[model samples]
Target: MNHGTEFSRRDFIKISSLFLAGSAALSTLPSGIVSGLGSNPMNGKGEKIVYSFCEHCFWRCGVAVHVSDGRVTKITGSEYHPLSNGKLCPRGTGGTGLLYDPDRLAHPLIRERKGGKQYYRKATWDEAITAVAGGLYKIHEQHGPSAIAMLHHGFGVSFFKKMFSEIGVNKIAKPSYDLCCGPARQATVLTYGYPSDTPEGFDIMNSKYMLFFGTHFGENMHNTAVQEISEGIRRGAKIVVFDPRFSTLAGKAEHWLPIKPATDIAMMQALMNVLISENLYDKEFVEQHTVGFAELWEEVKEMTPEKAATITDISADSIRTVAREFAFHAPAAFVHTGRRTNWYGDAMQRIRAIQILNALVGNFKMPGGVVAFEKYPLPQPPPAHEHPAYEKEVHSKYPFFPKDEPSNTIASHEIVQQAITGEVKALFIYGVNLPETMTLGRQTALEALQKVDFSVAVDVLPAEVTGYVDVVLPECTYLERYDDLDNGRAFRTPFVALRQPAVAPMFESKPGNEIARMITDKWGIHGVFAPTVEAGLDKKLKLAGSSLEEIKKRGVLVMPATDLYRKPGEPLNLNTPSGKVELASAQLKAGGFDAVPKYTKHPEAPAGYYRMLTGRKPMLTFGRTANNRFLGDLATAQENEVWVNTTVASKHQLSHGEYVHLKNQAGIVSEFPIKVKVTQRIRTDAVYMVHGFGHNAKELKWAYKRGASHNQLISKTDIDPAMGAVGFQNNFVTFVKEI
Candidate 1:
């Protein structure tokens, strides 16, 4: 079967049976299964059981690692895991491949000389640590501590950020805020005074209506949301999807509105207009729980359904039908937050408009509706002793630093760019890959690295950003590390899970926390690393009012809470200046953005040009899983393909499965194997492709030279004025057949 094609129920069952049979066979084998049992050297059944979390992506699902004779035998999701529910995503299932990857950096390597292509031979941990610390100290003494910057990626990044601050480096950044979830978070903060966990828990099982605006939960593999969505469907929830493309989620939706791309806000405004004009909204909720209804009503009065129809390309009648359905559904309605919101200049506003729709339907904080509640509890450590040196230094450098700097630095992308231009230095990158994940003009980031006297990247894989680093530290994967699981913030069912090292570090790789301890020791700082991960668990236990040993033995912990809902006549205190869900934002006033969620015309493509959009496939995470042989083999190519509509393909005489060169407004062009998906399902003016292709790493033999980089075509745009996020979807490009 083609990898991209869907599997029927019968095929799915067959695949599941095969997987179960394999698991049963593996389980029945002796605990002493070793390398001699199979052709693969790493294939082994070891006696030691390592319980750890999968760090492949942020889902952080629990897994049991079977190690036989120091080799990982198999990886599977923990059936006992409450979050993952015994099913692992493709990335999680392929975790072992990463452990035994041939291309993995096994030891510390340093550049032979500045700007040199050749690297010196691998060195011992002691030698590497000494060189890295010494280099950073030397740079700090000469240029001040601000000469360095740090860009950390994945979870457990707090330890590194603390170390950098202790050493007096003020510059820090992560792609999380810029490339991924920044806009949604910013919008949440602006409206709620704090960032609400997105796709925020919906009582989907009981919901009667679910409206998705650009949310592709089914395909994104957010375990909880996907499970809930499926459950909701089983219960007969009306799922409506609004997007420009026929997304996987849209395929399942009862109504799929192929609106013009980047005009989601306009559609949302039109919905609001209909609800208000027809008096179909929750009047009681609006009158009692909200404060700015009058102001919002005045602002949206001009935006009639007919006016919005012209801007959004949806008929006014259709808008009224959906609006009436949502309002009539009452407490069982929700809107979901999807990934990749850093698309258009008004992305945050677009989300805000969608969120406002939920408020109009009286769904905010209600069961079977859009809800907000505290996460499950976990054992937390006692607060660390203050390192006055670090405290005083950080305050002096970053005067506006929030009390919780790591959690508060949502705008770090802009800060990192400023730091690169010598505005701030002293960078420490813990686990993120900035060069590949950030927006266009990566050369500027590279230049920023060059300008900084000290740069450090600690990652399991030696990524593109690591090549430009002054120090490249080998960090162990989650399988070899001890970390705490805090599900108390996102899930209503409070729980604490422990990640026990399934095996000892295979090479000289150290856990990030251990590395952090070394840095603190070198600087004469103390107490950051507990005697054991169990001791750290004791702290979280105190927070949860539970015993540490009990949590460890149970492997999982849950705190059940009552289903809470918003009280009657309570104010809908959305944190916007108006206190109501703002149809028009007062916050965007200074930024020169339209206060109303109005649709602006997308950049007109010259005669032959088309707008391009990017999406994800189930087999990959942004650039991370392309190296897995088992998963990679499931897809013929990892490159971004131009999914042209049938009309456009015929007009251009483009054939399916042909090679093409796609060029953008900035003159950057990428060549790729094109697969023209001709269907009325897509809009004629646009084309869709998958991201994380266009691998440039020669070291990744299988992935290199396969796909085209979406970044190449994204440079000719500006940041969203309201949120400072890169407008990745605003580019216009032309596709040419590769002769």
Candidate 2:
């Protein structure tokens, strides 16, 4: 097995330091590549262990950060954590790489004008906080608190949210829910009385049939879900996937319907119709636990398998057979209500249909069906400071906002649109890169930020987003600082996870709690902010029936499990109007929307162009991970590639592995040429590419212009009527042979 080479333990240790994780380094690189790897090692002195949780991805696996002297040397998943099960994903393993990235925002920076051009100058904590607070207070004093908008992404979001909420700056936005999971949340909450707080993980291991509609389960490896699915598949759960691209999950499935893009709704409708017509539904369960079934039946009776086949490009017989199989499995089968929902604007309706299907199968609270998880009670923040709250507006031309969950996440595009008109004066960006994640195009985002009178960004990394802001506040990486307590990483079992410092704050970077304290102190905000990060964590620890000492010792505190899954006699405690599953939502009827799912036509890609679809990879978390050296090295699309159908290549006189310049429908051309992956894996009508690549930030040397930036081409979007999520799928593109 040795390729004529051997290394001693000392040599391995010396070489391993080059890679982020020495434990994983041997597996990643091949033989003969090791030539003095660990050049600049972490200044580990006397080895000390610190308990922490990863902020790498949203999964937040509990970690054991080993330190020597005052520097973090290693990060390993806490063996005690049930979520990660002692294994770190690619992103989590590369936590140190992000911490050590050269392009990181090491200190506070204030934007200044030099020769009529905006430039950033380094500032101390006092200088940065005072200036930022001054700008915010000015905006508040001149206009209103509502004129100052706060936009955030990632962990410690609640701190920012509480500040804005208490301060009457009601224009706060958490783009994760608003942009990513809003549609799914709206549909699920409407149907079953609550959203899937477990995110996308269902009780798949309890299932005999697991169905997916354009959902990539294994591909986007949310650690716990990966284990759950692997166990489910092992137990003979029949996996069925429907996607335009033959994804990794699709490959593992017993059946993968290479579905026509934007036609999943039709197939879902057919499945429902077939289940009802064949009397495959659990009639007793429906009668006892559901409302408005008759109305649902009325809508879907005409949507037969034959009709669905015509719309979805799936055969009628196959659709009927799949439906029959799905229903026959009954309460043991689950139709996965996914996270990133459909792009057809009718995403809410489609998700409703999925939830309704699961309901019809009588699976709520069941072992293998839609199981609700538990959450521990934590200390609530002190009552939000009272304020003169102006009537929060929808703030967008594209309507279809959920009546209930309105005004929380003002759309990114809408913010930009308003900023362009000078309606928004002050914008605070926190931990998010708008140029990468937001829709309406990169230039548009830049312009919008430029138009704002004052803007600020807080992050560990310098980014294209930071370039547009008036100030940049460098926040320490997850490894270097403490934050508020994190809970419910494993939703089924209630647990409290803590983030503790593995090392002293490298450079002048500070944690979020410190940043909040300084800003509030400068602004003279009293009785509104936590005195220290430990105070907040202590409050949470006290509430969770655990102590800071226990957390420091074990990294996580897992609560004992209860008989949570629905047993025979339990009632389905639905929060809908009738306290039953709303087969036909009365709430929807109240809002003048559809009560039951309806087939809606999606616009086809015009003549020569293909609908450009963006999907996540296990190694990347949006564009945030693109700059990580370890991840970049392992990244398949570090120099991003488009997944075009083999036919697309021949038709356009293109070749596999050749470079192509893609010009999206809005006349936005790719910043760099991307490699063409001409394969039969994707549909001819559409092209696919992994997101978070093609980053244009000049400071991110490893990531810059390496791949095609999907956000750059994401110039068009369809807003979901119910959830107000920007549909990134309505975008189309045509490739140019010559740049």
Angstrom error at residue 634, model 1:
1.3
In candidate 2, list every pair of residues with a backbone clash. Answer: 18-38, 45-68, 45-69, 400-721, 694-707
lDDT string for model 1 (1-739, tens) is 1111111000100011211112332343334331212223344344555556677776677676767776676776777666676777777777765665555556776544334233445567777677667666666777766555666667777667666666656555566665567677666655544565643656777788988876777567776677778888898889888887888889888899888777776777777877888888888776655555666677677777788788777787778888888888866887766677777766676666766677788777786887765666443554575423223233333322233435434345555565556655445677666656655545555556565545567877656666666567878877777765555356656556777676677556788777877876766767666776667667667677776666555456766754657776666666567766554456555445555455566676667778888777776776567665546766533455678888988898887776778877766677454555666777888888777777665555556667676655666655666655666677777776653
TM per candidate: 0.87, 0.92
Per-residue lDDT value at 534 in model 1: 69
Clashes per model (N, Cα, C within 3 A): 29, 5
Error of 1 at 280 (Å): 0.4
TM-score of 2: 0.92
RMSD (CA, Å), candidate 1 to true, equals: 8.9
Give me the runs in candidate 1 sitting further than 4 Å from their true place.
1-50, 114-118, 168-170, 378-383, 387-405, 408-410, 542-548, 567-598, 636-639, 671-675
Q: What is the Å distance of residue 39 in model 1 from its true position?
A: 12
Which lDDT value does model 1 have at 49?
55
Best by TM-score: 2
Ten-residue stretch with the least lDDT total in model 2: 7-16
